[model samples]
Target chain A: MKPACKSCTKEHEKTNYLHMKQQIIEILTELRPEFDFTQDVDFIEAGMLDSFDVIMLVNTLDEKLGISIDGMDVVPENFSSAEKIEALLKKNGVK
Target chain B: MSLKFTYHNKRICGILTVLPQREVLFEEEMDNYNFSPAKSMKLKLAMGFNKHRIVDENTNVSDLAVFGINYLLNNQLIKKEDISALILVTQSPEHFLPATSNIIQGKADLGTDMLCMDINQGCGGFVIGLMQAYSLLEQQEIKKVLLINADVLSHKVSKRDRNSYPLVGDAACLTVVERSETPETIHAVVNMDGRGASAIQIPAGGFKMPGTPETAEVKEDENGNFRSLENLVMKGDEVFNFVQTKVPPMIEELLKIAGKTTDEIDYYFFHQPNKFMLNKLADKIGVPREKMPSNVVENFGNASGATIPTAVSFNLGDVALTHSYEVCFSGFGIGLTWAAIVQKLEKLKFNEIIYY
Candidate 1:
């Protein structure tokens, strides 16, 4: 099989990141339907996400994305927003 | 490391959970949290925090154990003379010198011939206590073991601390383990990570961190929960992560060692941390929601090591007394420990919950 060219690989990475971002938003929305997860706001500061919700989100991400998130990375910062959660997933080698 | 073992001719004959009559609702403790009512209510819904049983300041572990032991003895559900060993598992001990099990032995008049010891453990104490009982039953002389798991953690939890107080409960579970002639095979496993010992603990009151006036000073944590060094402190995220990552694998290992599948198990009577944690765990482990009862914490609070047996008695009390089932009992927490036991529990002589 021929290796992908640099430009194609970059485009693929961007597409994967966007897909993960959308999935994260969907998961967060399911967890707390009342919250507007689409907005780029700090879920923790807004009182939309608590410890229980964070744990639930971690479990859901692990199940849906097939990634094992390290316990050390379960801090509030990683789960404070959808973009942060996508970054966390990438850090966990989600793609 | 996972410590796996198997036993023959051993069975858990009965379980009785004694809960304090006092009940405190989450609605009443809403003001304790720094979060707004709306946020706290959302948490209450997610965590399944309705009410929990708590003991008064005067009540202790021994009080509940004595009451339960006497109940079994007076009701003739168990003969006092048949008890070969008494194991009291608790994080809250009445004194530092003499063992709390000795105190219960004296109070319950359980006779001097049997062995008496105290195991300082938390949530994983129930399964650990049962393992100890099975070990005692290995001896030819030992016939039956009376394992008591009780904790009065409410006294150690700061009421103003929303994280721990609302979920903290005071209860005792008295389980009867005996040597059965039916040659039943029981598989058990225990795994511990001492590195996470501080995840759930009271910083003071122990020999290492003796309780001082300074330790009693209340301070607010970043999460807005208030507690003293002497009070129970739980890093919610750390503990939740530990359970989510570690427990399901431990349960899988247990089922594999036992040569059984999830479908073969009748119930997963686990330590009730809360509804949210348990629901996530059930989903991860591929177990049906009905099989794993998470209502114990909401109805009776998280009684540390006592939650496993309390879950069993509360949910299976009536049917378990008359029918046999292949049950899995698991507990994870405190010692940063997680343990499980899979066996056929046959027609318990008594399985019930009583209010103290």
Candidate 2:
């Protein structure tokens, strides 16, 4: 019974992660609707996001998830993909 | 760490800014780079940049500064002898050997007893220049100091460098600081980090990497702007992060040190980088947009050291001279440097932007 409960908790956490990713996608789309976030994981590399866009994303994440991103976290590596952004959010105690 | 300083005896009496008459619209100029109209429109709308002033190739920062100083002297707004020290704050000097201030002294024909020096600074130069002027008053018998903040950044940027060229304007400002007996004090906070020095720099033309044939060879950057290492290059993301993360806290600390809150201040003048960045900063600091003038870059482009004085002279115009103001001035960039000054200005005789 304990093993089953652990499995259920793991599934729940996976669902939560998916929800956060969806929220991030929504934020990116709202900012620059012309780009497809799914296809372009290299958003930072492709020059899809300018400095203003990054600031807006940071502001939105703070407003939505109650997380503060610092200068260190603003690196292109952390913002290159939705998955990486989610990892950053988790590292900042978003969960 | 932050350095805090207070000055009780010095005050700025007047400010005059001069700009080149020639202008270039970004949309029209971007055609050479093949920057799409849609993208151009987006940048214009988002950055608040439409047109910028550019000087003729032959003109330098000294030409503009001399013109402004002569105007002040000729109009009898400030007498030549009243200036005990002349400070030229700029990175783009007329010559590397004789400091631009000394040459300007010769052209302005000031007395030999006067002190003249050029400070190699940009961006937050006005605040730094003002700080130096205040300190001089404390030491010497100086009664009035002529502070000239000027830069011709257009000459520093390459024509093919769309990222920087379109946003640079050429201008110079002359401000007169005199010893005053008023109780008003100037409060300043300054901070610097060499870690971010390379973020905005001309990689060559200095002693460390003297300009060579290869340095002048133009190559296209990933962003498509073509420029050599000899020209100015800015890591926009790093600068943006620095301004957003570091500057607001500095301003907050400055207000705390001054024993004033954001609301008590009448206007917050900033070194104009762009409308978007300034708006974001205002939101972060909770200063009202009305009090923050972010359009300096939009109308006149970023004149580096002269941005603040240019903003004041153009935005406030003569109205700044008519009333007592609790003004907060901040300049951040290029040295990866940021400085803020909070002071009170009473009636002033001159405040205007002149076109050359």
Per-candidate DockQ values are 0.20, 0.17
lDDT of 1 by residue, B1-356 (tens): 48998999988889999999999899998898786787577677767788999999999999999999999999998998899899999999999969999999999988788999999989999999999999999898887899999999999999889888889899999999998879789999999889999999889998998999999999988777899999999988889879988999999999999999999999999999988788778877888979999998888899999999998888887898788999899999997999999999888989999999
| Regions of candidate 2 where Cα sits further than 4 Å from its true position | A1-35, A40-42, A46-79, A82-95
Per-residue error (Å), model 1, residue B201: 1.1
- Deviation of model 1 at B40, angstroms: 1.4
Writing each residue's lDDT as its tens digit, candidate 1 over A1-95 gives 43389898888878877887888888888778888998878999988888867866776777677666665567888888887887788788876
The CA lDDT at B335 in model 2 is: 81
The true-versus-predicted C-alpha distance at residue B290 of model 2, in Å, is 1.6
> Can you tell me the DockQ of model 2?
0.17
lDDT of 2 by residue, B1-356 (tens): 47999999678899999999998888778775636666566667667768898999999887898898889988999987778999999988887789999988988788888899999889999999999999998865787999999899788898887667778888999999988878888899999888889988999988899999999999998777889998999888788789988889999999999999999999899999887678778877888878999888878899998999888888888898888789999999988799999999767789998898
Candidate 1 local Cα displacement, residue B206, angstroms: 1.8
Task: Record all residue pairs in model 2 with backbone atoms less than 3 Å apart, i.e. clashing.
Answer: none
For all candidates listed, what's the TM-score of chain B alone? Answer: 0.98, 0.98
Report candidate 2's interface RMSD in Å: 4.6
Choose the strongest candidate by lDDT: 1
